[model samples]
Target: MLLAALIGAAGAVGAAPAAEPNTQVPAGSRHYAASGFPDRIVASPAQDAGSGFAVAWRTAPLAQPPLLELAVAGDSPDMGQVQQLRASSQALQTENGDSQHHRVLIDGLQADTLYAYRVQGQGSWSAWQHFRTAAAAGEPLTVLYFGDTQNKNLSHVSRVIRQGWQSAPDARLTLFAGDLVSGGDGEDDNEWGEWFAAGGWLLPGMAVAPAAGNHEYFEEFEDTPQERRVLGKHWPVTFALPSNGAAATASTTYWFDYQGLRVVVLDGTSALDLGTAKAQASWLEKVLEDSAQAWNIVVVHQPLYPLRAERDSSVLASEIRPVLQRHKVDLVLQGHDHTYGRRADDGASLPQYISSVAGPKQYRLSPQARATMKPTAEDTQLFQVLRLDDKGLRYEARTATGRLYDAFQISRDAQGGKRFSEVTEGRIPQRDCPRPVSPKGRDDRCWE
Candidate 1:
């Protein structure tokens, strides 16, 4: 495994766990505390085509406004023609402390070009970091897809993300199926800190496309008659996503195109329980109808067909499924079931559904999973790498230890029809929990 090799060679150290979920922040804990140096820097796709993108970062409150220095990457240490741009800042109060989040949307750049940028600290400038723009049309694209990293983020999920990045170092974008953190209240800044620390320096370069999960929303005023659910406070400051989605949930739902592929992200938690189903459904139909890309993919937190019986959502099946079917989206990536489940294309339809988890949390598979899902697993963490080229779209799912778990390819024929074929020759055996010989403790199931 990449992680094992790196650790053995470098004697790397793991991140210390942050504060427990929804707990009080301990005194003198610098794990999540904001400092003068910038941190949690991330890049996101802009609403426009491949010409522009957005970058965001956080730091301790600054007396003077922050600035961003940008320049086209060149061979020498001396950066020529550097452009210093002012960034917009937002003051935020969190349990970790008061901090400022800054964002800049850079535009009018050459396609398929690399650029270096750095942000101003309190009295110093940050180290130069580099990011590449989306390639021109018809260029092959590679992307990494990850399921819920909601628990044990720093301790366990860190290795999964690192291994995925090592496996696909040139991937342009990373799609996160949500429930990114265990706490929904959004007040636990430490959880967000853990998530950022888990991704480390890798987050600043690659573009991120994330969907909001139910855990991103939490009930306010608990035990009161006026209690209500609201999205976490950290989301807006953390991600500078496109605002071209449905009116009701525009902040969490959006779309971006890279090369010949278009990625559409949705807020399933808001649609199912926040009275935005009709609005999202209407917007989804319009987006799909207007899409011009060769390949289209939809990302949402809840699955249309869940692996566990209790986790099923009828609203998703009714509202989202029809739009996907009508538009013939190539793939639908989902999470929130805490297991791995996939339904390959049936040859007549276009989309194939996949739901997976990347954290340590596990849940028992539904009884029908064995009959319905060709390959399924419980108590396993996996990440997927997807490559899109002229021949077709190739997808491979690998375990946290870098072993190939599942793989398939979706290709188009001369008649423009799609076909699905699995790589069955060298795939490892399907992972499933062993049936217990006798009941023990309070439950008979293998998962708690």
Candidate 2:
């Protein structure tokens, strides 16, 4: 069923059959409010970013058909010169009832140009928002990367995002390793609302590329809930991602080039399952071999090498590590352990693998983590800023309050190899917050 949904055959394969009509509905605010206006607006890079970009927004029923008006950013307000595009709208049933999801692709845009766009609701129009396109490859660029912001989306994670934005005001794009929300089934309309609330107005003008996490899959079947776990239904309809990936995992496992960097997003959860692992692996090798970009980065939810004490991702390490090493992938950004861990590749050109958490949830470090990874942190939420150019790459990880915890740089040689070095000279000491005590007033095994 999961594979079927990934390939857009959910209907034929049978979507998780509706069990019982949900009686308990959650409450949301602002964006989720049925105010007959467009909300939850977001921008994403198009497959051919040199001439295109995409936007998605939500509206209530009976609202005007979604319309987008766009023009090159200019001083004069020339309404006649602007172009309007109609978005494809789909009705999705949510905890807040039915709402329409609309997406529009603004193509034929010139590269490296600033453009202003606005969307229309039934009778209301959103204020204009602005976004810039990617400059050509080889040019210097800065991007922000985040880990699992699943829990406390509006309260805790929002601070990390706002802090990152304030720190890297010149960032061209944002990337999430996975788990953007705590709700996997997608029925938690309030959670998605909180996610948008957390981003506030920042996401509307930025191109965001996110990978899927295990939490993004909701078990929809009532008959055999344990066996059936497909992607949250809202995922396919919410974001307008590029459809150039593995046959079974297109939107969820695609690759795109931003300036000089090539980012490949993989469906790690699917790869753990035998049925889709081979296809994902084959597609990964092909994408890497065909790419000539200066920098190659891979983003996924699960780490190739697990960082927590109770977990071991032997399957991913054995199946995917060799290909990554062979291709000399520059960086691997991952999430899922609710901790911070960075491992410099041992005697390998692919020198950086970082697993970080960006939400409130924190886990105790595994005993083996001390031997495998350096500059590790527990009870810490982090966001990393990466700057890439012809010289090399610089990365810095900071806490929500804007305190540096880890930093590093990778120098690229003339022959395309990389030399890694730590740059954490004066960062905050590693956080090892004690586990919460139970009602019995005893130590939690997490500390053990």
Candidate 3:
């Protein structure tokens, strides 16, 4: 395996036990500067929805007044300079932090056309970011998925993300499973630079969809003026997205269709386990029932079918998974478990889970769950790359270097159920992580 591959899913990673008795690291010290990033950007990182596209980004300390300009991208990436059409923004204070958010909607865009845009805020206007509107009829496309880039974020985190881009340069979107930052006391801030680096120019190079993971929260970490003044600021101001996906609200929860694929996003924090479960569940049922696309995918911060019994089945299983199975959702993507993991079909989930920092790391198994639930001494760093083509869909679990670890392909049957043919990059058997070690025992405090 390539070193990159070994660094990713194929390489071994140690358990990320919180408060690991590290005298060297300060409490939440790693992320104190997360909000310092020059910008926070969100685009309809999912496939294009018809006639529309979403864009969002954060402005710290509140833009005197947030603003953005929308326009079409130049064909040559330098040609058609985007013409500013309109702009809008808002301020949100969450339990975590405070931030200013700006979003703009553009219309009259032709189908399958690439539209580039830029944002304007206090003392600055952003470089053009581009996205395409959904095709009238869906088309096959490619997207990238990253599990957890939260730990030891910095330039290293960007390395994992950049490889995905290098592997699929023309991908339609990048799917972020959450924990973009370490939420505990905002130590995740230090790594924001790496997050941006991972996307590099690709952030605006292509769209990115980031779910809110458990670590994204700000749990009354401090009564300090700074923490109390801003919540969800960094996220909203950073990226832009479609306004109509989920009840058309600004929260990260919503759904959009790219060609035949229907991508649905839920606030696992809100719908799965948090108080929003009842409401999000109802919304999910409606969204899944209403979807007209052939392929349906769901995304959330937590795993619906967690691999380890140590952790509870993510809130979504009780609150959401049934809806997916009922709707026959094609793919479900997540990140909180940290370890790179996936399921071939809507069956029982694999026992393997990967959680690691972004930097190079060796893999280590957690305490065993059962005689049958131990991770092999030989572990690999893992990640996933997915391709959707005219014939069928291909999902590969790969490590950091770019070697395929686990593979599964699904073609549609006349009955509409997926016919799955599975493959592995190398000739290797499966490895299972320890049963869910003890729960992180995180309360719903920050979520509230």
Candidate 4:
């Protein structure tokens, strides 16, 4: 269902069922708002940043709109400086008895400076939240990347996100490849809470840029005759984002600059389902051409390089990779495949491919692809900590317990030649093993 148009600083939008308008009367089914509290905060400002940010939250039908406040820092031991920071407030409600809300864009923030804020509803505003603005051009910075954090999220999501931060305490930004939540389940209430609970305030701590995954694509199911997009009410209004650059009515697909890095965010669902493929492709190409940042990273939900047979149908592989190669995109971070993979296509003409999974699950790599990737260890829950340098880049894929699974380095020469090198000197155990024996079902001799 298309989330209803958000209104005012605190507005609630309704989710119109895909293919069918929700016929159920919005005024009746009064559960009486007696069960629990609806507290959520998601940040994604629409296009035209205008040096502004958008905020969204959820609440009970009968509850009063709380005092939503903004601040400069979060949970400071030095609360004495709260007055020194600037702030704002607002309120709202959705058509389906759901209380939706928004906050004023805490205006006039210093570029690349720290700001703290908070929310109030049930009783008082929650803890003070914090985030920073993008740095000026030509500055080098580090950003965290993750793919497929959907399954068994509550039990395992925190370990991976916090662990990544633990590894790089000062990472400038956080980017998610896709499938933030399992689509089939939690299509209704509790998922958003778990997402925020798992990561807690840490997600809002840094500038978060999440690519749209299949889970994020909720609206009328135009493809199927009897289907409609469901429960997508939480996406647009829950989060606050920079209103600078984006395409279309929604800012779910937008781009931002962080420390000389032009991080482009695109929605795979839009490219595949909507006829906006050409429009997005042209915009992406233009962004790449116009961007002079030292590093240009593109983050999306789908993978160009597939690890499983099911993942082979990548629309972007045909539609997007050509543009990336043409524009000299530095990195492409994506999810959907639940495995650990880092393959630099020595064969591809330009740029490099580094795909990974940071989840509680694990996947086995094929020994057949060893000609280039050389599959060594089998780890389901692994995160890559990549450090970009002028010379090239260094990547370390580690297990949740902090075990190093794969390590590789790429050094670029002045002539623009890239050198791929593997890590043989980590504290972790060595995986320099041979390929496993073939199964009885196939012939190993005449293979790919």
Cα lDDT of all candidates, in order? 0.83, 0.80, 0.57, 0.57
Q: What is the lDDT of residue 63 in candidate 2?
A: 46
Off-target runs (Cα >4 Å) in candidate 1 are 1-28, 184-187, 344-349, 434-448
Each prediction's number of clashing residue pairs: 0, 1, 60, 37
- Give per-residue CA lDDT, model 1, range 1-448, as digits (tens): 9989987775557532223333233454646777889888888887654787888898999986699999999989999999988888888888778999998888898888899999887887778988888887668899999999887688778999999999998898899999998874444688788888888877888888889888888888889988777998778888888879898997899998888888999999898887788889899999889887778999999988788766657898888888998888999999999889888445544578899988866666797766778789877889999999655898898899888888888897755577878877667888976544212321323432
Which tens-of-lDDT digit does each residue in 194-227 have in candidate 4? 5666666556556566776777656566578866
- For model 1, the local distance difference test gives 0.83
lDDT of 3 by residue, 268-306 (tens): 654533467767778889988987776777777676645
Flag regions of model 2 displaced more than 4 Å. Answer: 1-31, 62-64, 77-80, 184-187, 222-226, 436-448
TM-score of 4: 0.73
State the lDDT at 48 in candidate 3: 49
Which one wins on TM-score?
A: 1
| Candidate 3 error regions (>4 Å) | 1-38, 45-50, 58-71, 75-82, 91-101, 121-125, 136-138, 186-189, 221-233, 244-250, 344-381, 413-417, 425-448
Model 1, backbone clash pairs (residues 3+ apart or across chains), number? 0
What TM-scores do the predictions have?
0.90, 0.88, 0.73, 0.73
Candidate number with the higher TM-score (2 or 4): 2
